[model samples]
Target: MSINELTKKLKNEAYSSLYLLYGKEKYILEYSQKLIVQAVLDEGSADFNLSSYDMEEQPIEAAIEDAETLPFMGDHRVVIIQNPYFLTGAKVKQKVEHDLKKLEQYLQNPSEQAIVIFIAPYEKLDERKKIVKALKKQGEVIQAEKMNVQLQKEWINHASKEANVKMTDEAVERLIELQGENLGLLIGEVNKMALYVGEGGVIEPSIVDELISRSLESNVFTMVEHVANRRIDAALRICYDLLKQNEESIKLMALLARQFRIILQVKQLKAQGFTEKKMASILSLHPYAVKIASRQSRAFSEEELKDLLIRAADADFEMKTGQRDKQLSLELFMTGIHKAKQTN
Candidate 1:
């Protein structure tokens, strides 16, 4: 099932017997695990119902033995197998194939007082193995992996809507700016903002400014927009602000390089019979952002974009180890972008 499906199932009291959460992203899994723990145990006695099994040293049977036990005061036990290195190797599963065969039986007929939670990084799972296939079929598995910045925005907006608050456009943008691609961190920030604003919530930019410290994302995007508009002075000011915020010159060069790469992709896709929506899907970008980026790509020719990327790489190298002045190297990058804009 998808992550949203798992989340809805948890909310609807539709508890699965086994919850196997493996992913590039752990935040969603952790959120669902907490929901399970809360559903099975009261706030006061949650500690009693929650228990962990370490699989790095213990065999799979240790977890089975633990699952056989009952909850102390509640009707269910929240059993978590953490960092299970055993699930990764083929030989280990081969040696314990019979031992794991019983787990399917248990899943089919789980004890009334038990809920098993399995967590491992997705790359660690041996997908070809029998036990792996069986476990996938036996329970609801969630892949809670890392998403891009635009996905992070959707998550923030959805999370806000779930909490019964309307996030202003600027507010949502500010949240993305402060916390990039970390829903867990965004959740924390949202909680604080909700409490800080209280009822009749108005999540304005000022409120965001008061709550979240400005981050490198705002600086990065502002620099990009400034360059796009041919505001070299404003771009230089933002670069100084980045330097004042202790951002390394090489880091700025790297950010510029990444932006140029995206612009190149935008230009290429626009030429290759791709619509903006198709470009968004292919690049995993927000529709609005794809539109803006496509327009921005019109401001530079492909050859000019290529030269800018090369200049960015040279600036990165010079800023990192060359004997030239660091600020001067970054200034040269800004001027190059300006030159490229003029030529286009």
Candidate 2:
């Protein structure tokens, strides 16, 4: 199940006998776990009914034992099993043994009074494993992967609704600009905004600008856009702003070079008939970011993208080698981009 679907189910108080929560996104996984706990056990019963076990220290058998045990003062017990590394094929740092057969047996016939949640913080589970197949067949599974842009926007809307506040379109965009795709950070910022704006109030661009601090990656995106649009003055102003904030010019140049390379890669992939979705997957970038970069890439020829990357590299080398002032090197690189843009 998608994270949103699982969230809806939990909200509806539709409890499952068994759950397999695995994901690369720690925030989503953790949030979902909390929802399940809330749905299964009441606040008063939580202390006595909730049981947690680290699979690394205490094997699956131990958790299964706890699951089989009756709740002390409640009708239902919640057993949370963390770091079920056996679900994935990745090698562990230390050899922590797990009894997979116990989990498989529990999956075949889970406890009616218990909700066993297997937390696997892994990118992908080993589907070929019998335990995995059994769990999938018998329980609810939520894969908390990085959401695409539309889903992300929907999530923001949902969060706003939950907070009893409204976020304007521009506010949403600005929040995304400040927070990027980290849902944990975004949610925190949203909660603060919702409180600041008060109940039923709309969060606008000014509120966002006042509350949120710009991330380095977000500024890099802006700088790249400015460069792509040949807005040299705005681009240099951003650089100066970064420098005033004690950001190293070499570090900024590296980020610019990385963005340029992504643009170039996106361009080359597009030329070879790759879709935006495919390019995003290939580049391991957020689809929204890939979309924005795709638009920026069209403003520059392939040669221009390469020229910018080369200039960024030259600036990096000159500054690192003490051949030029660090700030001046970056300034020169921006000027080079302007000249390249003019020529192109």
Candidate 3:
């Protein structure tokens, strides 16, 4: 099952006897766990019924025992078992031993009075294991993998609605730009923005611009945008600001080169009939990022991109060889871009 499906079940108060939640996305896994805990356990009796164990430090039998034991002063219990390394094909780093027979027995007759949640922070599980097979057959499984950008946007809209805050589509895109595609960080940013905007308030792009800290990667893109548009003054100003913050010119050059390289790749791929989704997967980039780069790449020809990359590489060589001052080389490179833009 996906996170969305699991969430629907939790909202409907559909509690399962055993849940096998595993994924590479930490946020999704943790969020699913929270939903399950909230749906099944009351706040007052949570302390007595809630139990967590690290499988790396303790044997699996201990958790099984906790799951089988009756709820304390409550009608049901929630047992959280973390880092079930036995489920994976990897070797365990710790000396702790797990009882496979005990776990297999517990899976066959899981307590009707308890909810056992096995949290595996792994990309894939050993599907061939009998224990894993039994759990899959007997328990509800939730794969908390990363959602695509469209799905993430849907979630953002849904989250804003739940927070009772109105958010425009532009605001949603801006939030994703500021925070990137990490759902966890984006969710936190949305929550903060919602609080600032208050109930029934609309979160605008301007509000996001004011609240979020622009990452260095974002700044580099902004600088490159200025260069692409022949806005030399703005580009130089951004460079100076970064220098004041102790950003090395060589490092900035490297970032600029990388950005241009990506744009070049995006342009070539687009020419080859690649969609943004396909480009993102091929380049291991966020779809939103690929979309932005695709638009930006259209502003320049392949020859122009290659020329800019060559300039960046030459500047790097000059800086390293001590033939030119690092800062001066960067400033000169910016000036060269301006001159090239005029000639075009």
Which candidate number would show the highest lDDT if scored against the true structure? 3
Q: What is candidate 2's lDDT per residue for 1-344, written digit by digit as tens? A: 87667777888878898999888877878988988898778899999999899877877778889899999888889999898887878878755677777677788999999999988888899999899899899999888886667766777888899999999988888788667888888888889999998999999999999989888888888888897788989989989999999998889989988988988999999999999999989999987677778888888889877777777778898999999999888888888888867875
Ordering by lDDT = 3, 2, 1
* Ten-residue stretch with the least lDDT total in model 2: 94-103
Question: lDDT (0-100) at residue 192 of candidate 3?
Answer: 90
Q: Which stretches of candidate 1 lie over 4 Å from their true place?
A: 1-14, 85-105, 123-128, 145-154, 168-180, 204-218, 281-292, 339-344
Please give the distance, in angstroms, between residue 82's alpha carbon in candidate 1 and its true position after superposition.
2.2
User: Would you list the clashing residue pairs of candidate 1?
Assistant: 25-145
Each candidate: how many clashes? Answer: 1, 0, 0
Of candidates 3 and 2, the better by lDDT: 3
TM match of model 1 to true structure:
0.80
What is the per-residue lDDT of model 3 for residues 1-344, given as tens digits with 9 covering 90 to 100?
Answer: 87678878888978899999998878878988998998998899999999999998989989989998999888889999999989989976777878889999999999999999999999999999999999999999988776777878887987898899999999998988767767887888888999999999999999999998777888888888898888989999999999999999999999888988999999999999988999999999988778778878977899999999999999999999999999999999888977887898
User: Which whole-number lDDT from 0 to 100 does residue 64 have in model 1?
Assistant: 73
C-alpha positional error of residue 325 in candidate 3 after TM-score superposition, expressed in Å: 5.4
Predicted candidate 1 versus true structure: per-residue lDDT over 117-169, tens digit per residue:
89886556877766677678877787776676666777777777666677798
Please report how far candidate 2 places residue 175 from its true position, in Å: 3.3
> For each candidate, what TM-score against the reference?
0.80, 0.85, 0.89
